[model samples]
Target chain A: MKEFETVTVFDLLIRYIKDGRIRLDRTRFEGLATYHDPCNYGRRAQKRFGHGFFEEPRWILDQCLENWVDLHPCRENQICCGGGGGALTSGYNEERIYYGRRKMEQIHASGARMMVVPCHSCHGQFNNIKAKYGLPDLSVKYLWELVADCLVWP
Target chain B: MTPENSLRISIENLERTRCAQWPHAQDNCLTCAMCSGACPVAGVDDFDPRKIVRLISMGMTDAAADSRWPWICTMCGKCEQICPMGIEIPDIIRRLRAMRARDKVPGILQDGLANALRTGNNLGLPKEDFVFILEDVAAEIAEEPGFEEFTVPIDKEGAALLTTIHNKLVNTHTDDLKHWWKIFHAAGEDWTVASDNWEGTSWGYFTGDDEAMRVMAGRIVENMRRLKIKTLLWPE
Candidate 1:
């Protein structure tokens, strides 16, 4: 803890791979994957801290998956998954799902089988959208889940 | 009295008292509707960010504040981010949320905030239950193929990482924590979670309570200080 600073799991994973702490078996994942830039870790943090973590998540995705794509209008301009701002827990399920239709459309347009989201709120929202839209082909997963799935043990 | 006439009376009252509170509420807004266009919840429950700004600018504060739309907004700051006028629309929405009486707040948000302030976590989870759940998950993981020695270290001082957890992960989806713990095990990273104030998401940020937010955040800081850990990997 002497020299370590607070960092996101994405940042830590990048460092771990670069510094040879861990090896990722990218060959394990062969599907087309798209990344969702979570508002808290991306745009809002950038606005507040003068730096947004746009690249760290993508870097994680690129390392773990052979085929990775971006959601249209991604990074700083990416749309909210509509479950943020406490809307998921706000007890407005109908309105929350209705609001997430735009995000659902984005996912549909991306044509990727897997959607990689870093935030729990986005995870919940996308899972609901997938259920509501009946898209069993599309799956929502956390960045850590992918990394753990692809870890190359010694 | 017709509906329009009654609305006029409320607008007059708003003009007399609340219009001056937000100095930039008027004149700065160009009524471009960019905020509305960019908002994810713009049309839900007839809530439009542009209309909220316009109504307030035109001394229709009561009409804007009285609606349930303000609570419906996720306050993602996308509208403010996209606003060419730099109107800070989300701030106005937050203020509107604060204006509502505590008991009048929608859903369980108010209760969550109260629980967070009282018990260090939004679900009011006791320290033992939180530890028990983590240990339970760890035991399950220990039986897995690769993780024969897995243990969720609580209060492990000087660990390289100290993490805060989302309440949903602990309360409902306890198995989700196994994903990160698996990663930690695979990477051989040093991380420990505090037995107290392990909540990561700030419900106070949602409920528009500054004091509640400070207390919730302060618990994390207090944990870090108590544990003497420097690096935090809070993902929420």
Candidate 2:
């Protein structure tokens, strides 16, 4: 065993892109897009781990897409998708969706047709919000999935 | 004019509820409503982050703990992020959530946490099915033009990185797994996953069950030690 260092897929993605190990096509995705910051990895991670990863994700998104915009308040100040802290499975789903109204508002205000989330819970919650809020055109994706789609394998 | 009506707070209860983890959680409050404005669930059930702090500072810790407000909150840290005093509101809320009885925890979260402890995954998915899904999905990835024979490495000893799976990836979003696998294939990364205890999400952390969280996290460490893998990619 080596030093036993722990890293998130986000960290690895950043490394792979920067190192040119994984090549991406910026025009892979069309239309405006936005990024949703999961609480644990964004604010909590920054406060506890000393690096919250706000810019790394945006940097990754920038690699794969051209027409992307950030939500009204992103990074540490970004709104949670309202499905974290077990709210998705807590059986308080109605309340959870209600709480996500702020997120929906941000998405609507951003005029983004696609939203990328790094956390699994946020991914699921945003999908549900999309259905409930009648944003049928709104596309939700995992940050890695977006990168995966943009990969230019040689 | 003297104050017509003022309620006295229980100093004893406030002292009892005070914990070392967040010493100034309530002490240095400027009563700014930034937290409430930042919180997504502030208005639900008449919930207010400021009110929760007021309760804790007033020695109504038990009330705050037992109230539906804390459970309603997703512990998103937005309030703490915007707080001028830099109060650890989420930490305090987690402490209060821990004080709740085990059975009293939100039902789905409680059950999922128990399942992860007993079966090494939140959904209690058996090892056989998990492996089958991995192989099946890998086969699909293999059909792609570049990847001729993609095989998922499970419990491969001495691998450089060990990635855990979020249960939903196996249960509902199996296609999502391919995204990472393709990336791994392109990056030529030597990563392996554990056959047992491969779940990445921690429901224990969600339900404020620190003991359960420790157990779940320990299982991953156990896998690392067993496999001799140095790096862990805990994406959840």
Candidate 3:
């Protein structure tokens, strides 16, 4: 719930930024951002009123930056970091690393310093995946958390 | 073997279960530890995913079935993703949860799961009430300054895709409800939340009872059929 709200909050905030009605100093980010789709959310999003997920946090990032950047291998088919489905609990520790190594490669490929995750499961999974697999350092935060942090504080 | 011996064998087999053996296990295959490392609950303090499976294989279910760790496992299958032996640890954890749900419900979590089975939602919230709350939430979203005309679909047939959210997403995290709502609008996509069977979180899957899981799946399928939605994008 907190996870989804992160996205929602991001959306609302972005809308406020672009609303053009609320005047403020706008400084768009000149960096790339990537989104990670959690399977649980994917499991439920497959057929709700004939829709598919594409621009998750990407959409919000787009609202904030013209160069939101591109993650070569985007959502849906994105590699599993081997942490969800109770896998992070320890039944297959060594195997989790083996599988997560693939995801580590992807984040390395993205070359983005920041990865936006809107799902709680994905947040924990990525952090653990990077540490476990020794992937290159990259900042990770909930999509909303990022937006929340960049509120252009008054 | 004599007939008496055969009878003894029959009784032992009858009493045999996944929980009946534990003391005999010396250690696990080094590769099998992947299951434990991949498990989400491993970091949750003493809840070793591999240990749970070891207990299951050894038939040490009494302690496992009673452990609160079963409820904590999200059944995400990361262990299976990395398992070299191809062991379906998530399935094992699911079965354990189901077996335990029968003996005990744990707390409001089980109650919510039961309510979902009985009333099509974790809270057993009435359909009318659910619809009312959904509209109310959406209304609030619309009134939030720039969200004046935000539209969240409800039973809109022939939508290209169906986006899903956990009931907990809307009921508890109302603000979060707008995350996807805003996504849908930004994409210029067509979607709707089902008036019936819209709850996407499958607690039945967690409970380990296949019957309940199927029931939950059946509801979602039926809802899809009703809405004529072809794809389901689940947001757990």
Specify the highest-TM-score model's number: 2
Which pairs of residues clash in candidate 2, taking residues 3 or more apart in a chain or in different chains? none
* Residue pairs in clash, model 1: none
Error of 3 at B114 (Å): 1.3
lDDT of 3 by residue, A41-80 (tens): 5432433324335555566665444544555444544455
What is the lDDT, from 0 to 100, of the residue A129 in candidate 2? Answer: 81
Off by over 4 Å in 3: A1-115, A120-154, B1-46, B72-84, B101-103, B141-149, B157-161
| Candidate 1 local lDDT, A1-95, one digit each (tens) | 35446787778888888988778888886777899998878888888788888988888887899988898889889888888888888888888
Candidate 3 backbone overlaps, count:
70
What is candidate 2's fraction of native contacts?
Answer: 0.83
Model 2 Cα lDDT, one tens digit per residue, B78-179:
888889888888887888888889899875788888899899998999999999999999999988998985799998999998999999899988998999
Deviation from native of the Cα of residue A64 in model 3, angstroms: 6.8
Best by DockQ: 2
Question: Would candidate 3 be rated incorrect, acceptable, medium or high by CAPRI criteria?
Answer: incorrect
The order of the candidates by TM-score, greatest first, is 2, 1, 3
**Residue A135 displacement in candidate 3 (angstroms):** 21
Best by lDDT: 2
Q: What is the lDDT of residue B202 in candidate 3?
A: 65
TM-score of each: 0.92, 0.93, 0.57
lDDT (0 to 1) per candidate: 0.82, 0.85, 0.59
DockQ each? 0.68, 0.77, 0.11
